[model samples]
Target: MAGKILISGGSGLIGTRLSEMLIDQGYEVAHLSRDPDKFSHYKTFRWDIQNSSIDENAITYADYIIHLAGAGLAEEKWTKERKREILRSRVDSTQLLLDGLRQHEHHVKGFVSASAIGIYGNSGDQLMSEESSYGEDFMAEVCKAWEAAVWQIKDLGIRTVILRTGIALSDKGGALPQMARPVKLMAGAPLGSGKQYMSWIHIDDLCRLYIRAIEDTTFAGVYNAVAPHPVTNQEFTEALAEAMHKPLVLPKVPSFALNLMLGEMSDVVLSGQRVSANKVLQTGFTFEYNYLDEALESFYKKHQN
Candidate 1:
């Protein structure tokens, strides 16, 4: 099943690793970027989402397209302008790709997109599956629009899979390092209620799920990209501290304090969804790291080496 793979957001933490893995597996991988020079190693195609333009060659040269380009939800304060940017980045980039595929003559077999579990919102202890009801929060709204744009490509007869990703744990980037830093400093404490369920996946496991979605023809629709077992904020904090051989010496961070510090964005940390990975697992995809402790250990072991 080796063929040319076109990836948007190829410069991101997940995309960079995915490109390396795909190349090692004998797939030709190219990136869609605004500045092609930034990705000298891969065949880069220029695409300006704001201007609604993409290199047609980027479209026609692919057997599969992985859409991962989106504004970081937690990067900036969700102001009126930033909110529009968040929605536009995901929706517009998707429209650009959809338009490219439609206008160009190409044989794109499948389209795999990155979506967040935030679509399920802060569902408390309820286990959120792919079929769960969507939340009404801003993050959820962004994901709704994003996934809707992706479905347009499916309507065009391309096999599409959307992975509603949970918090991806990695030492390279994403949420792991940010969480571990305070632990190493002996100031580690659970945030919010310390009882909110945190559904997470090791980065490698997440990338592997993306690969499976591309290679497995039976894979379609949405799947939750998360570990089999989800832990509470307190459990995750403890596992993280133990992984780095650190001590937790501080009290839990209060939700009110987070609200004061982050405004609306505080929900990102103060609340969470207990997402299920059974949907992906039922597709015969096995996660390398199913538990929080082992996942944390694997990352810190790499760091220690």
Candidate 2:
């Protein structure tokens, strides 16, 4: 079932690794990028979401499409305008894909789009699954709209899968880098109450899930892409500190100070939901890095040399 796999946001954290893994599996990979020259690993195709223009050939060449395009939600302060950008980037990018596909003659088989467990909002220690109730917040709303647009791909008779992904732990350029940075300086501390559940997946496991979505025809609808065992913030910090051979000597960062610094974005870190990966497991997907300690060990060892 491995054929041409075209990806949006192919230059992003997940997409970069996913592209490499897919290529290794003998799949012809191409990227839908704003600048064709940006990626050297694959044939990059040009796309303009605002103008509703795309390299129609890219759409025609696809057996599967993994839509990972979206602006970083936690990268900046959520001003009124930034909020609109966060929601618009995902929704509009999807619309552009649909519009381009409608105009092109394509034999695309499946469409797998990235989503977030944030769809469940900050539900404290609640164990959230794919069927969990949606929480009322900006993240949930954004995920709701983002997923709604992805669902429309099914209207084209393309099998679609929406993965409600959690925090992906990688040393590349995601939360891990920012988290490990403080620990490296011996200024590490648990965030907020340190009791918020952090549902996370190793980057390798996440990349494998995307591969499964493309190959598994029955993989329709939504699934949470998180590790089965979620750890509290305190546990996560301690594991990371131990991995780096550092000690956590500071008190938990107060929620008030975090709110003052990051505003609404602080809620992303301060509050958490324990997401379930049972749905993904039922499909016989095995995770290589299920525990934080093991995953971090692999990440650190890889870059030590």
Candidate 3:
């Protein structure tokens, strides 16, 4: 269970923490970065997905590969060019990894990939599972293509696990800080309809699941990386406000305003997916922060102003 692991997007929020955890557990860890020299702390390999090139040594050096590279979906407006970048960043990079693995002779035992619940689209109230039908939205399309590319790695006879992750809540980065910022400023409110369900998982829980995927040979196919209980936007906002010792003095942010402000990318916040983590739980993967209040408190209680 302890061997060399190569992580794509190893500098990302999840990857950074996961790397530390893996290294602490006495596993050899290396990063597959676009600029290898930029990361001096670990052994780094280079891969240029746009040019469809990857270091052959990267493929050979790993007992397992964790794919987390992709363009940030919410980082920019969904311009035509940005949309293409989002799709290509995921699909092309995965295809490149797949191609490199095929061309090289290596003992890559497993492929653990990061996927999103966006595959289920704006699924309203129905709880989405691994068997849920896909959504027709743009994110859904991106996730479908991304997962398709990852599955092709299975053709190489490697165990492949894809976690259709929900909004990862971390205090260092990702969703929690942005959500807590407004609440701390006394302007916190739900986005779009306050009733929209927000399925979230604590970052530590998520990273642990990723580690489990690496160690557990029986883990295959897709599992939703979300908490057991998904709360509505209003409920989440209230919990966040309480955790941060702040007050919600503002009304819900209107959907039309978000659409105008964010363009088509607004769907990321306006729409909601009530994803289920039962599949992951059935595999005996327990969650540390399953409830919204505890998850929020874990991040905000000590630092609350």
Q: In candidate 2, how many Å is residue 203 off? A: 0.5
Which digits, one per residue and each the tens of the lDDT, describe model 2 over residues 190-226? Answer: 9999999999999999999999999989899999999
lDDT of 1 by residue, 84-172 (tens): 99899999999999999999999999999999999998899999988999999988999999999999999999999999998998788
lDDT of 3 by residue, 47-153 (tens): 99989999999999999999999998878899999999999999999999999999999999999999999999999999998999999999999999999999999
Model 3 has a clash total of 0
Error of 1 at 87 (Å): 1.2
Candidate 1: Cα lDDT at 161: 94
Candidate 3 structure, TM-score to reference? 0.98
